[model samples]
Target: AEFEIPGYLVWGALIYAIFGTALTQWIGSPLVNLDFQQQRFEADFRFNLVRVRENSEQIALLQGESAERQRLSERFGRVVGNWYMIMRRTKRLTAFTSSYAQAAVIFPYILVAPAYFANKIQLGGMMQTASAFSSVQTALSFFVSTYRTLAEWRAVVARLDGFETAIKSAAAEAISTSSIGVLSSAGRDNIHLQKLLVNLPNGTPLVSADSFTILGNQRTLVIGPSGAGKSTLFRAIAGIWPFGSGSIAIPAKATLMMLPQRPYFPVGSLYAAIVYPAEVGAFSSDRVREILIAVGLPQLASRLDEEAHWNRMLSLGEQQRLGLARAFLHQPQYLFLDEATASLDEASEAALYKLLEKRLPRTTIVSIGHRSTLEAFHQRKVVLRREGDRFVLQNQAEGVKSSSDAPLA
Candidate 1:
């Protein structure tokens, strides 16, 4: 009778554990995908809030606060909707798991109670059988109690694996023969491009240039119709865009600086913003103040110690002026400006150009702009014309007049 009771209790615990584990798995499978999407939705909602904060000035100027608020609320709604689904699923899972645990404790006792009553076993034997049965059940039911945690772990692992794969693929392509290649040359006097083809990230051809040279001390302006891949060419030269074929050779040990339409400023003192990309205090405060005054930001000179979001607080024109001020401080060998002065008026733009010419006489300036006034500042013009599916660079020097000779018509 003792042997029979022990065998029966052991079999009962094993069957119970197997059934509970299978049920838990079936109920928890959906939670893995749900948790993955929940994380994505939450990240999206938070990113939207950050975007709204970054562009708050533009939204306020366009009186789009209500529209922005609606968009943000909708993003939050997605997060909340997904979270509710997770909660419902989790609640259902919890109910099953809790009942399974409680039932496990009582199941062993019920299986052995008949033997004790029938004089097949004493109280001690009954208690020992229940204890042995509980240990077996607990050992086998580990999955039932930890299924939710395992599902969450699986989702996290999948996300990390995807991220690592993307990073590796990008790194591989950066050195691939089919991608835009940036080669370094020993000379420090000229930038050269040999049969270079710059493409969009989707493998669509964007810009093509062949045997082009931008010499030191040259002021060149790049122009084209909208979407002609003007800014993209600059990106290719900077070795950041890696979606096309051919080689771009740059002078070795040369400093290159790119100023965009909207310059980014770190949230700190004016001195740091002006001398950015350089260590703070790299240039003396006196020098930074002089450049600020040169760029027509004398009012800012006195506020070098003030910390604020200069990009949002100051006007775009003011930001452009600061960008030029930074360039003046760095004195890079090659400077690429993509509509850097579009925010300023022609008068201010001309003055800034003059400041560059006076201060950075040896720095080669390659500018992308639509304003006719820009042509006056450049000694040469590089035009990008649509050719089949790509825009080809055509260097023009005929009738190319300096700003001092004739203003651009």
Candidate 2:
């Protein structure tokens, strides 16, 4: 035998690679699940911070600064607590990987040293044997070196899978529900609800009407007790609430707008907010200032060009005035109000309604309010009364009032 070099080096390198990869997988498996929780907890904490900033004014008004601070602290604590677990897991993983890497350097020499001492191989032959062993070990331990990256990738895949599943479920539900069909009509001058039944997302009936019609250019007021599905009815009419049965035929080429009690204004210039749902330059600056003054917000007229968070900067009563100002600017054929003036006093409420009557004489107005003073502005009144599990609409007797009895604007 020229050298009698042993083949144990080759077999030893393969065994070490297999053992190291398997151990690394076992130790790092928990990291995949922890990474997912850490991401969610961190995202939740960030979202809570944004929510606090958005509602900063309300929190200050309620003097709930300490409560909000405590809530934020609690949410942040979860983020920190989960991060600590990730760090510990990573620490353990690093310890094993580092040891495994160092051992591979000296391991080949240890296997070939015995053969060199027995005089079975020359120094050059022993060096070649060690180099070959090193190459095999490196190839086998590839997974061991990249274990952390694989864990993170697994977590990302899981989050994306959950998001995709949720979207598929919502789309499927929409396709399956064939009721609450919405049809648009061009020649008609009224809104028609035929065999309509509005229901909650859980299938509980809210409001039912066999046939209902809102004629063109009419002032109609809807009155009902608390939780009588008054707002839900408006949502259905707007073609947004889908948990219902029957068809809503809307006039074609007609514009409809809904004003809630607390109207939303985007964070931008007051001029932009005033003509929102309308493009910028839709109305002249002079026209916007004039409408602002007419709505009793003369102070804001000068600040039309000033950019601010108008919703947070303005009071509820002031916001309602701005809402009416918006209605005046847009002048849609139908304006639906859902307790849109609840924050204003009785006198101010009457003045706004009078302004609407004078400015939008042709626009059909529908209002939901509990106040008796609102009755004087509308020509017809309707009420929603509970009939079994759902509410049915009842048309009240038409009240007649001369122009002399109306409140002056």
Candidate 3:
């Protein structure tokens, strides 16, 4: 115990450092999973609260406050329950860390006490030894003290990494060489599809159109039975659905817009919502008001500056009008309307189409609808006729025709 007595401090610190680090790591491993779960629970609870707020009008009309409260309470209970679990685990970690720190402070003296009593070292020498031991022990316990912070930081980093990975994967698939291709045909007015095939994400073939042309400046209508992939065909032309092969040659420098059944309007002033995705001051206030009036939304003309959730505040018919207003504002060279007027009565729908023709005479319009009335608007009828195992938008005259007709141009 000659030289061994002097080295005892280092030996004791080394032993504790190994065991302490291992203990903290083992105790904190579960924190990552718990932290992630807590985040999900909290996010879900917040989402439900926002949903109720957005749909408050419908809830009030249905007198479903009690049902909403029950659903929200269940979500909140999960949030609190998961948070409690995190607290319990954190409590255990903090307790161990506190106990470890207190013991570490006294640990140096316990090691030096034997030499001080044996008279092998003076009081000053013992104190100095304890001080050096304390410094060394502090340096060695760095990881042990900060395990909680490390665990939480790792959780956030892991979640971000997961999101980034998912985004990259989706981007890669969308632009893959094997997927559908979008090409630009300069100086050409029409969009041409050569050997175009569209499929679902699961590789199920949906639409097959080879050597089909969407004639420029001509009003086109696409009609098919429900779930016949008519919408998917539109997506393919828009260059968003990439699960297929073949090239879609679009006119160069052409601005295209697609209005879905339920058009989206960002929560903001009527003027801003109507001309969304465009700068706020892109269109003059006077022109916007005029267009709103033309679309049969005279009431919204004066409320241009009024801020509200336009989608919820307006009925579906009114929303469709606003969607058309967006088209008129943008005046895109190509416009695809996917049942964009189905909510409106046949009379209003017909008026809207006529206004579209008058306002954007040069814009090529495509409409997707089930109504027989829609045929009166479009010049060329493209039916997604089922031939064998696939569908094509072949040309038709007057009423809906069979696949024996020529391909739609």
lDDT of each: 0.88, 0.89, 0.87
**Which segments of candidate 2 are over 4 A away from where they belong?**
1-18, 56-63, 107-142, 400-404
Q: State each model's C-alpha RMSD to the native.
A: 2.6, 3.3, 4.5
Better of 2 and 3 by TM-score: 3
Q: TM per model?
A: 0.92, 0.86, 0.91
Residue range 236-336, candidate 1, lDDT tens digits = 89999888988988988889999999999999988888888788879999999999899999999899999998988899899999999999999999999
Question: In candidate 3, what are the lDDT values of residues 337-370, reduced to their tens digit?
Answer: 9999999988788888888877898999888999
Q: Write the per-residue lDDT of candidate 2 for residues 1-409, one digit (tens) a residue.
A: 4654366777898899999999999999999999999889888999999999988878999999999999999999998888898999999999999999999998988988887899878889888887888888898889999999999999999999999999897666555555587789774578988899989989999998889888888889999999999999999888777788988899888899999999999999999999998999999999999999988999999998899988889999999999999999999999999999999998888888888988998999999999988888888888998999999987887765433366764
Clashing pairs in 3: 395-408
Residue pairs of candidate 1 with colliding backbone atoms: none
Highest TM-score model number:
1
Best by lDDT: 2
Ranking by TM-score: 1, 3, 2
Alpha carbon deviation, residue 48, candidate 1 (Å): 1.8
